[model samples]
Target: MTAMAAEIKKGRKFDQVLDGAREVFMRDGFEGASVDEIARVAGVSKATLYSYFPDKRLLFSEVARLECNRQAEEAMAEFDLSDPVAVVLHEAANRIVRFFLSDFGQQVYRICVAESYRFPELGQRFYASGPALVRERMSAILQPYIDRGELVIEDMDLAADQFGQLCKSDLFVRRLCGISKETSEAEIKRVVTGVVEMFLARYGA
Candidate 1:
């Protein structure tokens, strides 16, 4: 386990602390957020907060990990793995696009990019919780389809990663660069449809 992970101890107020931290981090970002504000928001004493999280960075990383996992799990729970490959791929594409454009998702991406140079572990944790986790779950969803000969994928990891990249298309950069404030449903469907079509063209059996 990471030193940060080792230091974090869960308690009855763990979620409460996380919730407050998330709000502060989202509003003020990692550097601007203060421990005092977080404790005040959580309604916990500074001492209580320090017991659960010895460092502010630890608290921030934990919040990011939990939120990313929660979003990914919620998406997976709604997926019908038995559906046709096209249907499942489309669902995955839509979920990926929506998530990449979300406020929290964008913030996490920014934080990882900004802090990874100084704190390599921050980026590692983000990858483990976000892209790596998604790839594993997506690979599981696609494996049965590949076995049934609906998709011809020699490398499950590469194919899953490609599908994820396809979902990004131009929109991800547009949002990241602040060219677009909100992605409409119609825009999302356009990207999703293209991703599914492109992926199936390359892999369909």
Candidate 2:
């Protein structure tokens, strides 16, 4: 059955299962988590769990996708796409990098990396939902700049990825390694300013 149709049949129960699964997966890791525990935590029968998510991989993928959506919304909720390009890019980079370097973000990143070896598809799912989503949204917002001759980007896809990676730089890696426990807004603003300057130098009209 289609997901919508399945949702219609299950309603909020499906969400409960997902919530339970997320808790279990995060706590136990993918290989260590058990479907039985998830069902118990969700307060649903095994049949209900199976009906909503036929397999562990599918369930895990959905859980990962939901978490990505949650973080993305939180990070970009107030984002305005119609601002001056420099301001917009700086704000976008700050939010994205800050979210990625946060404590919860590190936990989620480790979980994804740990599970990726066995279920490489989960890595792909996370990328598509997370970074790929940002790249597409940012590119869409910047296309008008190119058309208006405000910027000279020849490949918007590459440009979007470049902008995001520049924000990451050494910050995200150092955070993941526990080399730094925090990133101050002042630091982030400094980093983003340089990134914006570099980008403008390359793409300015």
Candidate 3:
């Protein structure tokens, strides 16, 4: 095979390993998951799995990192900077709640919660790759509103964090505790609207 074909094959193998890692990690938490099982699931030999990821820790970290980035990207994609503040907040809340309810999102949270004590670095990895990024993105959006005197806030960072916490409280807790059901649209809208109204009342122009 040509060099290009070899690279393509390598890429495909990496994807296969990631897919298998996600499955194993979700089914058996990061601490309980094993590289042998992941390789078996991926239909690859242990050596092949190692070729893609040097160890189980690395593989699990990459899987969680990728999923977190994907969730953040999905949430960011739905945001419309030109929309009204209320509309923007509501849409952001919906996206956040939806992300927490996703399978990968819930599993990532489980891994963080379960393994944080044993592998404290995993917690930091999750926070840096996920919530930290979310907060940063949210702050960027809110900063414009604050600068334009549309929203009055002592701290845009705090406001963004509170907004995300409010939107995620219920779904995130439930999902972390093993509840797989999605939040109802009506519930999400009601909560988001209430939060947005309160925020606007406190900070609106």
Candidate 4:
């Protein structure tokens, strides 16, 4: 095989390992997942797994980031930055809430919650990789509104965080506590309307 083919194989193996890692991490949680199982599921040797990710924490960090980024991209695909502030925020809130409150998102959050005591740094890493990444994207998305003078914001990061938290609201807590499955389209719109209204009230020009 040519060097180019070898590089392509290596890249494919890297992605396979990441997919296996995500499955194991989601099913077993970070603390319960094993490197051996990850390697087996990935169809790679322990050496390959270690070559790609020296440690489970490193693998988990990247996995979290990738999953969160994937979800954010999916959500952002539906967003319209050129819309009015309320419309833009409403669309964003609906998509974001659906993703963040989905089963996969809850599982990821549960892993962080479960392993936090033993691997506290993992929580920070997860936050920086996942939530913080989305917040940065949100800041970028909101910039156009600011440029057009549709929004008056002192800090984009803070505004992004604020909007995210507002969208989640008590619904996330209720879901975590097993009292809600408020992720239906109607429920999402109901929740997001308030979030969008509140956010625009604060920042709209």
Candidate 5:
């Protein structure tokens, strides 16, 4: 483990600190979140919080990691790998679209973009925990179909990344630009359908 990872001391209150930090970070972003507020929200003393996370950046990284892992796992849990390629892609597309439009997702994306220049590690962690993890998961899901000669994907990584971006569609842009809030299920389905069909048209064998 790296020095930063080693410095993190997990204990009974470890999850408590992460949960509190997630809430504060989501609400206030990276720079705006305060150690005092995190400690207060966690119901732990400053010393206790510090013992678990020596720096606020470390705490934020941990929160983003856990949240991203949780989302990726949750999205994969319902997936039936045995299903048709399009069916599975649709499921993945739906989950990705919803997540991109989620408040937590938007906040994390904004924080990473805003703080990444000053704290490069912050952006690296976000990409590793979020986009990289999702790409790996997508590749895993697609591999079975490729072996069966159902999907002809020579560049699995690029295919996975493309699928993710396709899921964004107009909805992600509109939401990010404050053009829409509270997207309807019909709208989400519209995007998901388009992504799966387009992706399959390109890669399906």
Candidate 6:
């Protein structure tokens, strides 16, 4: 095959591996999932799977990374930092709730938590790619407001962390424990509005 054709084949194989890994991981948890199973599901030979991911651990980690990046992209895409604090906060909070309530989100959270005792690095990676990145993004958006005295935050980083926690805590916990049956649009609006009000009361213009 030509170099370009090889690259295309490699890309397609990677996509297949990711899809299969997600399905296997969600169904069997990290500890029980097998690379052979993933390869079979992906419709690729075990050699092909290994060509893309050396082992199951690397494959699982990549899946988490991709999911986190996808979520971050989605959250950041619609976000308009120039909006009023209330509007930004509302939109951000809604996005947070939506992500946590998603099936993929819940699976990723569970996988990290479940694998943390055996693989601390996976949990660390999850944090770095997921919540930590989100907090950093939030802080950047709020920094200008802080500088302008539109928001009265003494510790912008802490405020950003707290903002994310407040918006995601309830739904995240519920989903983590498998108790959250559904997340309604009305609930999202209420939670976002309430969190925004509380945040503003403490650190708004």
Model 3 clash pairs are none
Q: Each model's C-alpha lDDT?
A: 0.86, 0.77, 0.74, 0.78, 0.87, 0.76
In candidate 4, the residue pairs with backbone N, CA or C atoms under 3 Å apart (3 or more residues apart, or in different chains) clash, namely: none
Instruction: Report clashes for each candidate as comma-separated counts.
Output: 0, 0, 0, 0, 0, 0
Residues 95-204 of candidate 5: C-alpha lDDT, one tens digit per residue: 89998999878777777787788777777888998889889999989999999999999999999999888988999888888999879999999999999889989999
- Clashing pairs for model 5 are none
| Worst lDDT 10-window in candidate 3 | 1-10
Model 6 steric clash pairs: none
Off by over 4 Å in 5: 1-12, 23-34
lDDT of 2 by residue, 36-109 (tens): 99999999998899888776766877787788778667656666656777887777777777767765466567
Backbone clash total, candidate 2: 0
* C-alpha-based local distance difference test score of model 1: 0.86
What local lDDT score does residue 97 receive in model 2, on the 0 to 100 scale?
Answer: 78
- Candidate 4, residue 14: lDDT: 94
C-alpha RMSD of candidate 1: 2.4
- Model 6 TM-score, all chains together: 0.79
Ranking by lDDT: 5, 1, 4, 2, 6, 3
* Residue-level lDDT tens digits of model 6 in 1-205: 3211222125567898889988888787777788888888888899888776665665777777777777678777887777777888888777777877776677677777777677666677778877887788888778877877789888877888888888875766876776877877787788888888999999987
Clash count for candidate 5 is 0
Q: Tell me the deviation in Å of residue 20 in model 2.
A: 4.4
Better of 1 and 6 by TM-score: 1
Give me the displacement of residue 26 in model 5, in angstroms.
Answer: 5.1
List the candidates' TM-scores in order.
0.89, 0.75, 0.76, 0.79, 0.88, 0.79
